[model samples]
Target: MPFINLKTLLRRESVGGALLVVAALVALIWANSPWAGGYEAFRSFTVILPVHAWAADGLLAIFFFVVGNELKQEFVRGELRHPRRAVLPIVASVCGAVVPALIFAVITFGHGDAAGGWGIPMATDIAFAVSVLAVVGRGLPPALRTFLLTLAIVDDLVAIMVIAVFYSAGLAWAPLLGAVAGLALFGWLQQGPMRRGPLRQGPLTRGPLRRGPLRRGPLRGLPQRQLPMKIVLVPLAVLVWTLMHESGIHATIAGVALGLLMRTSTLPGETISPSDRAEHLIRPWTTAVILPIFALTSAGVTVTGAGNLLASPAAIGILAGLIVGKIVGIFGGAWCTTRFTRAELHPDLTWPDIFGIAQLAGIGFTVSLLIAELSYPNDLGLLESAKAAVLLASGIAATLATVTLTLRAARHRRRAPDPAG
Candidate 1:
């Protein structure tokens, strides 16, 4: 099947990401304008659902769904399928998350309640990071893009674990039970005879199945057949949201778990036709619609007193951590691992080239912003300061990465031998 090429879609994400930056700027300007109050009101305006349950749950659940889809894809077909192939990126990502959290914890150590915000810098915004790589246009290799993406996915997984473990407030046994039941039901549906028909014949044939022509069955394309996966999963996801709201765990944790469950992939290294109908359906929805909306909603922030940002501790912590942490964690970790393990760097890339890509990894705007909001919703003043820091750090990192890589590319071009010679 001819599926939409991910490389092409990723290129489009670069363009969309530029638009998001512009939109964010417009939102900031409008929020601080004379009509600033109106901007706040608009953002705060509630979109009520028939089910009182969902309105209280907020948009974080949707965010988790997208996260789940991405995670599933990576595990199924992308970077994480082969443990050996995935090891270096995973190590770098873990270090990237851990060092920043440790830094934040140390800074906010004495303040018990405030220290909960330590998870704020743990996520990497793949869109912004990829966009920077696109601009850099040289020195960076395609493998670098894959490596960054893999690391970002790993970073997200760690962030989810942190949110689930540390950020949860109280435990409500009943609702938690309901969530478990939903997951079990969803699991049964996935493993049942319904999914076996096409999937058995489909390209993925590594675990307990063989490649062969699909068998026709009553389970073909029944939404009811697929119902348990989405139906129980989504509502239980809502239940998790409600439980978290009551339990004091961040509501977003529920979203991430549900997202992890939703993503799927084909078997390893199989050249499945891109034209597979399911892939066509899921890919566009995820890339274009779900991801962009999440970025738009999450990235808006009003930076009223920019000067305060320079002096704010939260601002300083976030900026320093992302700009310093990402580059150090990624290149440093990769370099150390390759040295010890003797793993080959992607053929076209050098240490300096990888360093430039590492700089791009500092583009943590979207995820950083979301985590900040979850970490500190009541403190708008602090939030604004943190947002400013994230923006500035990401911008500087992206600029450095882009300029250095482009120059390196130009130098390489100048030295290339002429075919006519």
Candidate 2:
């Protein structure tokens, strides 16, 4: 397919963010309105599959797939390819996750049930953060965006590991093993073509896939060696996803596995990489549809009373962890990394810029809400409170970060030389 321009991609993401906010607002209003009973009934009335489950497990899988592809491309061909350059963001991301969790734990201490929501604050919603940065920090260095992207990617990697290791329930050994085998096969298929397919002898038999063939005029007689992606890769992806779901792990892991296993090279005739192709194909849907539906479903928090929301320890912990903890953790972690190691901040970024970006990272919306649900499955009250806190903290963080970044942007604009001069 055609490659999307970078500016266009960023613009789309900004629109996606706006849509997310609108969807969540609609949900919140519908849930809290006098017709709240109707909204509740609609959410509760399940058909073949619950709308809630479809949004969380099914739609979010596409989001994770896009995320996985991004991480793979970054490591293989983008910013995270170099260890020296990646070190600062990696360190900052780790500290960013750890501090929030620790703060949540400390605040919710002694409340055994509430403490489980620690992971709620550990995620940085990339869509919201990126949207805010792109809009308000237009005059900022591109490297700042790179830093935030890398940091958020690493933060997501940590969140995924936590979900896999901590949140999964009811271990089923047989399906787990099957998932492993399926993932292995998926990886092998990407590296080399299926033995029975036409691809068995052509591209894979020769060397790494190359761009030259596709760029050159189509050869009339060259045997098509690559298996049709729909016929082979799609089914394998479905099987792997099913196996993972049955294994009591989050099915989204399948998307991540498939994405990381994708091949980025072509054997002389290919112009697009499997990873990039998957991204281009899947990203538009995830951003525009899946995420908005998810926000609509998961963000419907009916505020019974101010006291109820304020009294919940889980909510308070999440609020503090996101607002206070993220700023301290990310900025402090960056500071410590620079102090101990030779790693330096981007040349164009000042301390205030880092502080603003750290605040932006705290605007955790979609993933945080998902984690809140998973954190407390039985307790509807706790779930609503946690959701409320996420919304509250995210709003505060967005406003504060926008103000901070806008000031910095204005300073840059004023200092810029006039063309007329």
User: Top model by lDDT, which number?
Assistant: 2
How well does candidate 1 score on lDDT at residue 378? 84
Give one digit per residue, the lDDT tens place, for model 1 in 291-317.
454444545556554678766667767
lDDT (Cα) of model 2: 0.77
Tens-digit lDDT track for model 2 on 36-97? 88877766668656777666667777776776777777778876676766688789888899
- Give each model's clash number: 14, 7
Computed on alpha carbons, the lDDT of every model, listed in order, comes to 0.61, 0.77
Once superposed on the true structure, which residue ranges of model 1 sit more than 4 Å away at CA? 1-11, 49-80, 104-117, 131-140, 171-188, 195-278, 286-288, 342-349, 370-383, 404-421
